[model samples]
Target: MTDVSVERRGHIAVVTVHRPPANYFDFALIHDLADAFEGLDAGDCRAAVLAAEGKHFCAGADFGGGGAPGERVDSSRLLYREAVRLFRVGVPVVAAVHGAAVGGGLGLACAADFRVTVAGARFHANFAALGFHQGFGLSATLPRLVGAQRAAELLYTARKLTGEQAVALGLADRLADGADPLPAAMAFADEIAASAPLTVRSMKQTLRAGLADEVAAATERELSEQARLWATEDCAIGIAANLAREVPVFVGR
Candidate 1:
């Protein structure tokens, strides 16, 4: 089965990520998503709904495969390059986040213009817990969504928030009425499609002017910090503890 698929519904494009269970992403997955968004931007699509077919929207990157920290950082640089391309998509996007959007996964959701989630859905910025700076352009996007103070708190604590709490904090835009978020997200996209397409696109461009450049710059800083931290013993401990489902004990080194 294809890992990524796009279905056209009227003027709304429904883009789906097909990696299962946790839907942990790598460079390939992120590249495919960017390609899909760019395709929609060049086509007749007015808006898009981004949804994943899995128990969780995305659990973040899979770090179980052993690699030296420097090697990992090198691989992540390419992935983050594609991630920034997502912010350059011209049309509006609504994410259907029915389950966990953790770490970089939260960054993916933030790439969308809005999010539709269920009450039990989870949103987490877990980079701090992983002993690295947040990547995927979250340094710019998270603060844009929820403001600087809330973004700082979320990043520092790596606190998990439910869908309702995410909406309360402006992390998520709407709460799904049911367990499934796809219908709600599609409906939201349809609303955008119903608007005058040219006007909507122009307004979106005006509102988001310079955002892609901002995200690009922010990702550069994030990458440098992450690369430095990835080599640290504290980061190693943090990754091990996370994989083992244990709370990490960090020592400043």
Candidate 2:
């Protein structure tokens, strides 16, 4: 089954991430998401909303991607590239975030010009917890939204921020409060769609340029951190502890 589902809503294209049981990212979802965004970027839609069907928009990279275990380190870069393309697309994009937006999922939300999350949405950049590298321009985007101090706290500590906290920290543009976020996001998307597409696109592009430098720097930092962390005993310890439902006993090796 296709993990990513895309459909048109008027001039708005609604994309849903359907990978269940936490909706972990896989190569297929990444590629299919790219296809969907490519189609949307081709001028068929004036706006789009990214929504997930399950409890999460995404967990992160599939641990099984490089093979089940003890395998090569294969990763999916499609989501990253496609997201950059989509972010640079000359149209409005709204992300409707609910449940857990963890690791790359938060990065996905960052790609959108606007976002709405349920009041109870959970925001996290738990890459450090897994000893994995960051993706989806998060290195640049997170700090850009949450400031250096807050971003560091979230990333370095792998703390999960609540939806209200996310909104307060400026990671989200709107919170669903007591209502379903999808409708509010769709309404907001419609509002943006009603505006001149060129103007809307230009504004988004212009606003993001300042963050581009940050994002680029973050890309290198994330890669470096990932490389170092992946080689240490910490990664396996963390993963094993997570899988085993136990607190990691860091040896600081």
Candidate 3:
């Protein structure tokens, strides 16, 4: 089964990460998600909810998926850009993030206009721990909420953050107290649907212009950083070790 799925419900578009057990995948799911994002019709819809179908939202990358180190993955960029386009469709987006929002999964959540998270939800980068580069325009989106220093701290430390910390960091706008956040997100979408379309579109445009600039900057940053990592021994060593099921020891090369 594909890890990610998209379905339309009434005027609500729901995107779910359905990969079970750990809820993880790499290029496969990321590409599917990008395609799903493209096919969504938020203009006719009231709003969209990004939720998951397992015990956790997403456990991050699928190291076991077996893709080359640099296989030209524009999925992350495409996903974020499509999100920008969707927000421009005169409809709001409210993400219902339950469980783990790690790495690129956090990137997906960050693209949403607002996020409603369950009480026990958790978030983290966890990339630094694995010695990899960041993706999904997080270079731009994350700091907008958590400040540059805080974002740097999170990335550098690869610390796991609880849903409470996520709310405190402004990453999550609302907490759902063990309740399913999908209903609340749909309600928010309904509020947006009932509002004047032009006004909504205009505000969305005005807001995203700032984010657009950030996205551009982030694209450059992500590219440069990833490109640099592509050549480093660290990336090769880490990836190789994972493939071999052995511990990678980096000499800071």
lDDT of 1 by residue, 18-108 (tens): 9988889999999999999999999899999999988999988988887987888888889989998998889999999988999999999
Number of clashing pairs per prediction, in order: 0, 1, 0
Count steric clashes of candidate 2: 1
Model 2 worst lDDT window (10 residues)? 65-74
Tens-digit per-residue lDDT, 65-156, candidate 2 = 33432222224333344445545555677889888888877887887777798778888888777655666688777777889898888887
**For all the candidates, what are their Cα RMSDs to the real structure?**
1.0, 2.7, 3.6
Of 1 and 3, the candidate ranking higher by lDDT: 1
Top candidate on TM-score is 1
lDDT for 26 in candidate 3 is: 57
Each prediction's whole-model lDDT (CA) = 0.92, 0.73, 0.71
lDDT at residue 194 of model 3 (Cα atoms): 77
Write down the TM-score for model 3.
Answer: 0.79
Model 2's TM-score against the true structure: 0.87
